[model samples]
Target: MKVDIMKKRRTVLNGKPFSIVDDLTKMDLTERKKWAPQVKQLYDSGTRLRFSGGKWRDSAGKSYIFVFNLTLDKKGGVQKTNFNALDACLSYLDKFSLDDVWRTRNPLSSGFTWTSNIDNIRCRLDFFLISKKLVNKVNDCYFQPPLQSDHHIVILHCDISIEPRGPGYWKFNNSLLLDPAYIDLVNSLISNYSSDPHNSNQNPASFWEGLKFTIRNNTIRFSKLKANDSHIYEKNLIKKIAQLESDSISDENLLRELKDARSNLHLLYKNKLEGIMIRSKARWVEEGEQNSKYFLSLEKRNK
Candidate 1:
């Protein structure tokens, strides 16, 4: 038998204590027999459930918030779901001390998060679950019209303040390694450094360190130049997309152009996220092997 495991995308913003978990289960909870085991396994994952009341919590005791398309309505009262699946989910939340932010904050609220164009059917299938202790911080919850999908965007507003953070250390951008121009520049820098006679009197260690410092400074400048170009290009794409959307509202012929622009923007973000993940994995592997102080503290704190 083949079994598929549910995966979640957990993101932690800088200076933010709580994590934002995006559900990628792609399982409809109403299909109890098919999804129950997967749901159970997901809830049983130690990484997801272990952070409650741990060092992950903020000053307000908020540890993490889950935003998911659960496909089961707890408030709509019209959507059908297997009793066993509902009970399992509710029981898991109760056991983990989790709270349904929307249900608790707005009991009488009625909204449809999904719609079927074929049958004109609507259902509330999205949810925001958070620590019960952070319920009071929920300022408001509402749903917006669908942009390009049948599902509406669920917006959860919280009253928590974001702590301001200072500019952190600079790390080499691994993506630059793929750029031919950057590679040529680096080669030129190394060639010049090797041929310079002014540093020939220096010791081996000092010479190596000086070469690294020079490369670092040049890399920083190169990265800044590329970043400026990227920002300008992204801004232009955003403007073009907005214009296409406005034109498409009146002329349906522009819908294809709008979609293409949106896809390009999405691809841009996807590439950037991939770069971030690569860097994060590389850092984790480097630090893990060294048993560095930062990772050691992180492991102990999580434990």
Candidate 2:
């Protein structure tokens, strides 16, 4: 039965526009209409509908049609990320100043720029962000699947389209990936200090003192960053790391060239051997400051 359902649901949702049904109860009308408008239809389309309530508009000034759920299950993702990931995802949205904001693509529905499916045991906290900054765009959605009685949360991509209505649908922008700007903050803190190791490290006491500030400062920004596709983040990190490592060599000058080389090698070793270092250090080694200091002290002893 599970296999049959999976096969059918996959067939239903594939290449079709999907609506996000955060609340299953929304399907029951008459009851919900008594209180507020519920989701009439939703979908994952190749074209985003710039909506003003129930109506939509396009660049040509034609009415944009809001497409909706063609099947019971919607399109999205699933993964196991801890609260830290959740926090990061929020910071990502906040980078765009998009948290706690009420926005409407359609007249019937409006919600905060970000919403968290929070629970105590929570098993998992589902994360989502809706962006008006790029209206008619598929906002961020990160979902994780469940197994052996687990429930998978569906995530979305920023480039997703609303349902295509009438005429030929615009081709989906496969290359359109909006950088979750919150990631910029994390990378800024980490990479901007590439040459100066002292900047990124917290004062321990001061760091924790500012932990709330760092963690909750711009939650919307970080969360969106966290929710972004990991492949892109990983690729960019590799590029940035390479660029910084190159710059690092020049910054140290010839006097420290030999020393910098050794330090660089150590950092590489420490990162590649992070698993081993964490075991020996009884903590995760701070790749930049801690490793750099370790090498500098060793160089001094040798001299």
Candidate 3:
């Protein structure tokens, strides 16, 4: 059974949601009481979980995530039947609502999880799952044996700080030139500048500089007229939402208004993304397309 961890409580292959527990195979393994605490500690220590043997895709088309299970015998050895061990791990994850955080490549640099006894099958049995909130806080994780226990110790280097970023300048929307009013304003500025005798005898460099200054001021003025009001409106809506949240008693209508405002804000952001993608062509080009011969052909044609 497939599972969509983000939406459905049970597994779903794709978008559809369904629930049916599959058959289970009974096998001998250690109880959960012994190593649950240790597992939880590592899980909480910002260590991402990963599967050593197979590739499993998640709802986001991601193959690996922070999937982990621990069903070791009293002697700290994997059960004879590995299936039982795997089942235990899945059940534990469901019980705790834990998700995997596996990146594209394996994060382990060097580590020997279990010493091979027969055919030199040294498996990396020791795995961990890092909390998403603490993923950024972790700097590094690796195995270092012989510190205290015979089992390899997973060392994590974490140096995290909370700092506020300064407010950046807003981006200008060049597409505003499509508006007839904007075109007319540009034409009026150009005509007025041309008619001024002060600019008639100016040197080539000075004429270019004056033209640039006039265009810049005109753009800024139009931007303030069109964009600034919308920005202020969004900010005010945010402030209203915050005020409502802080209040001891919030009216239903006020809450609805806030939700509507947030929805509108989201729509505006969606439109902005679409506009940016349209203007900034090739920014989101697919892999292998960047260095393709097709780009060279286009450059030649343009020239």
TM-score of each: 0.41, 0.17, 0.33
Candidate lDDT scores, in order, read 0.55, 0.34, 0.46
RMSD of each: 12.7, 24.8, 20.0
lDDT-superior candidate, 1 or 2 = 1
Task: Quote the positional error of residue 20 for candidate 1 in Å.
Answer: 13
Which rank order by TM-score, best down to worst?
A: 1, 3, 2
Which 10 consecutive residues of model 2 have the lowest summed lDDT? 66-75
Best prediction by lDDT: 1
Residue 204 in model 1: shift from native, Å? 2.3
Q: After superposing candidate 1, which stretches have Cα over 4 Å from the reference?
A: 1-167, 249-256, 282-303
Whole-model lDDT for model 3 versus the true structure?
0.46
Per-residue lDDT of 4-101 in model 3, one digit per residue for the tens? 22124432323323232211111112322333354455345422322222223332333331223322211123424345445655664565443333
For candidate 2, lDDT tens digit of each residue in 1-303? 122232233212334443322321222443334322222322222211211121222223333212122121121223232344335434534543333222233333311111122221122222233434444454443333221122333335455434776743222221222545555655565444344555347566765455445434455455445537444644444344333322213343642553444354445444534433333443334534444445544434543
Which whole-number lDDT from 0 to 100 does residue 174 have in model 1? Answer: 77
Judged by lDDT against the true structure, how good is candidate 2?
Answer: 0.34
Per-candidate clashes come to 0, 46, 8
Order the candidate numbers by lDDT, best to worst. Answer: 1, 3, 2
Report residue 248 deviation for candidate 3 (angstroms): 8.3
Higher-scoring candidate on TM-score, 1 or 3: 1
Clashing pairs in 3: 2-11, 2-12, 3-11, 3-12, 47-130, 66-100, 66-101, 69-89
